[model samples]
Target: MQIIMSGLIMGCIYGLAALGLVLIYKTTMVVNFAQGEMAMLTTFISFGLLTKYNFSYFVSFTGALIVSLILGAVIYAVFMNRVQAADHLNQIVITLGLFLIINGVAGLLWGHQPESFPTPFSDKVIPIGSALITRNDIFIFIFTLLLMGVLYVLFNFTKIGLAMRASAQDLTASRLMGIKVPLVFMSTWAIGTVLGSVAGMMTAPLTFLSPTMMFDILIMAFASAVLGGFVYMPGVIIGGLIIGVFGNVVSYYYSPEMKVVYTFLLIIIILYIRPQGIFGGKQTVKKV
Candidate 1:
C-alpha cells in the first residue's frame, strides 16, 4: 500500500511534466528538448526566492512561474521562431543545443549539488485500510489534479485557448482569420514552461533540486508523451500513470536501474505496433 501510494504521487509528477511536452508538441510540432532543463532552471529560481529572499512558498511559486513565462517567450522569440522554416532535424538540434546551454548555466549558477526543499505539507502519515499515505503525497496528488483541471478549463472555455488550438491545426488559416500566429506560438511556449516549472517546484520537495534531476525525468516524460500520442491531454496523463506504475512495480520486483531500460523497451514495442501511438489520430499533411 505504501508503494502504491508512492507510485501515485510520482505518477502525478510525471503526468504534469509530460503535460508541457504535449502542449509544445501539439502547438508547434516541435518537441522542446530543453523542457527538462527549463524545469531545472525554474526550480533553482524558486529555491533562490524561497531560501535567499525568505519568501513564502506561494510567493516563490508565483515568481518562478512569471520568470518561466518570460524565459519561454524569450526562447521562442530568439531561437524557435528562427527555425520556423527549418526541418525537423534542425529544430531538434536547436532545442538540444538549448538543452545543453541551460544545463551548463544551471551548473554554473547552482553547482551540481542537490539541495533540500521545504514543502507546505507535514510529514505525518495517515493509515487507511492498512495503507499508509503521507501528507506530502496527498498534497502532490491534489495539487496536480487541481492544476490539470484549471488547464482543462482554460483550454476549453478561454478565447486564447481557442486561438491556440486553431493555430495548432492550421497556422495559415488562423493567421488569415486575424489571429496573431507569433503571439500564439509564444503563448504556447509560455504555457508549457509554466506547467513544467510548476511540476518542478512541486516535485522538488520529494526529489530535491539538482542540475541532473530533469534529465531522467525528461526521458520518462518523452516516453509518456509518445505513448499517449504526443498531443492528447487525457492520453498523456494515462500514459504517464501507466509508465510510473510500471516502473515502480519493476523496481520493486527487480532493480531500480532497470526501470528506464524497460521503459525504452516498452516504447520501442509500442512504436512498432502503433507508430501513431495509442490516442493519436491520423493526420493528413497538405503538400506545400
Candidate 2:
C-alpha cells in the first residue's frame, strides 16, 4: 500500500502532464516534443518570481500560468499554426527543435544547477498503516484531481470546450460551420500549456527546479498517454496511475535505474498488442 500510495501520487502527476500532451494532439494532431521543456520553463519562471522578486507562491504561480497561456498561443500563432497543414514529419521536427531551443535557453538563463522550489506543504507526513502520506503527496494528489475535474467541466460544459471538440472531430466541417478553427486550436494550445505549467510547478518541489526537471515526468507522461490510449482523455489518467504503481513496484523490487527501461518495455508490449492504445478508438489520420 505504501508503494501504491506513493506511485498513485506520481501517476497523478504523469497523468496531468500527459493530459496536456493529449489535448494538443487531439486538437492539432501535433505531438509536442517540447511539452516538457515548456513546462520546465514555466516552473523556472515561477521560481525566479518567488525567489528573486519575493513574490508569494500563489501570485508567482498564477503569473507563471498566465505566461504559459500566452506562450502557448503565441507559439501556435507564430510558428505552429503556419505549419498546421504541413507534413507530420515537419510538425515533429518543429516541436523537437522547440524542445532543444527551450531547454538550451533555460540552461543559459538558469544555468545547469538545480534549484530548490518552495512548496505550500511542509516536509511532514502522517502514517496510515504501512503507508506514509506526506503533505506534499496529499497536495499533489488533491490538486491534480481538482484540476482534472476542472478540465472535465471545461471539455464537457464550456462553449470553448464544445468548439474545441467539434474542431477536433472535423476541422473542415467546424470551419464551414462558423466555428473559429484557428481560435479553437490556439485555445487548445493555450490550455494545454496551462496544464503542463501546473504539473511542472507542482512537481518541481519534489524533483527540484532545473532545465531538465520535466524529463522523467515527460517520459512517464508519454507512457501514460500511450498506455491509456493516447487520445482517450479519461483512460489516460488511469493509465498514469497504473504506470505509477508498476514503475514504483519495479523501482522498489529491482532498481531505480531500471524503472525507465521497464516502462519502455511495457509500452512496447502494449503497442505490439494494441496499436490503437488500450482506451483509444480506431486509429485514423485526420488533417489538422
Choose the strongest candidate by lDDT: 2
Candidate 1's displacement at residue 138, Å, is 1.5
Question: Superposing every Cα of model 2 onto the true structure, what RMSD results?
Answer: 1.6
TM-score of each: 0.96, 0.96
Q: Write out the backbone clash pairs for model 1.
A: none
lDDT of 1 by residue, 193-257 (tens): 98888778877888878998888788888888888888889888888888888888889999998
lDDT of 1: 0.88
Go through the candidates in order and give the C-alpha RMSD of each one to the true structure: 1.4, 1.6
**Predicted candidate 2 versus true structure: per-residue lDDT over 1-288, tens digit per residue:** 999998998899999999999999998999998999999999999998999999998899999999999999999999899899999999999999999999999999999998889987678889989899988898888888898899999989999999999998887789889999989999999999998998899889877888989999999999999999988998999999999999999999999999999988998998899887889878666555
Worst 10 residues of 1 by lDDT: 1-10
* Runs off by more than 4 Å, candidate 2: 283-288
Task: Give me candidate 2's TM-score against the actual structure.
Answer: 0.96
Clashing pairs in model 2, backbone N/Cα/C closer than 3 A = none
